[model samples]
Target: MITFWMQMRRTIRLLWSLFKDAETRGIAGVTTVLLLSGTLFYAHVEHFTYLDALYFSFTTLTTIGYGDIYPVTAVGKIFTMAYSVIGLGVMGSFLAVVVKKISQFDRRR
Candidate 1:
C-alpha cells in the first residue's frame, strides 16, 4: 500500500501537469463547473443537503447511478437528464486526461 505522503506527492505533480495542459482548453475546468452547477441546482430544487447534492452530481456525471439517492420532483428529473447528458462527455474527457497523466507519471518512475 502506498503511504499517504507518496500519494500526496504524486497527486501534486499530476495536478500540476494537468494545470499546464489546461491552458489551451480546460476540459477539467468545464467538468468542475458542470459538477458545481448540478450540485447547486439539486441542492436548491430538490431540497437536498449540500453533501448529498455534491454526491449526486459526482455519481451522475460519472454515470455510476447507485440509486441510493436521486431526484424526486419532475423539474429535478428533467434537470438531471439534461445535466447527465452534458456532464457525461465532460467527465469522460476529464477521466481520459487524468489517466493519461497517471500513465506518464508511472513511466517517469
Candidate 2:
C-alpha cells in the first residue's frame, strides 16, 4: 500500500513535469483518451467493475499484461487485440515524449 502511494506520487510528479511541453501534453491527452476508451469498453462489454476495467486497460496498453484479468468472450477478446495494437502506438508516442523530457533534463545537469 505504501509502495502504491509512492508510485502514484512519482507518476503525478512526472506527469506534472511532462505537461510543461505543449507537444507532450497533446500526446498525454491522446494516450489518456485511448485508455479511457478501453476502460469503458471493458466495463460495457465484459461487465467489469470500473476500477478493474481501468486496471486492465492500463496494464494492457502498457503491455505489462499481468494476466490477472482477461476477456473470455469472443468479441471481448477481439476488441482487446485491436485495442492493444492501437494502444501500443499511443503509448509509444507518450513514452517518446517522456524520454525526450528526461533527456532534456539530463542535459541541463
Give the candidate number with the greatest lDDT.
Answer: 2
RMSD of each: 3.1, 5.1
Give all TM-scores, in the order shown. Answer: 0.75, 0.81
For model 2, residues 1-109, the per-residue Cα lDDT tens digits are 9999988886776667777889898988898899889889999999999999999999999899999999989999999999999999988888888898877765765
In lDDT terms, how accurate is model 1? 0.86
Q: Where does candidate 1 stray beyond 4 Å?
A: 1-12, 23-25, 102-109
lDDT accuracy of residue 88 in candidate 1: 76
* Residues 19-43 of candidate 1: C-alpha lDDT, one tens digit per residue: 7875314886787789899989999
Instruction: Please report how far candidate 1 places residue 106 from its true position, in Å.
Output: 6.2
Candidate 1, residue 1: lDDT: 53
Residue pairs clashing in model 1 are none
Q: Which candidate leads the pack in TM-score?
A: 2
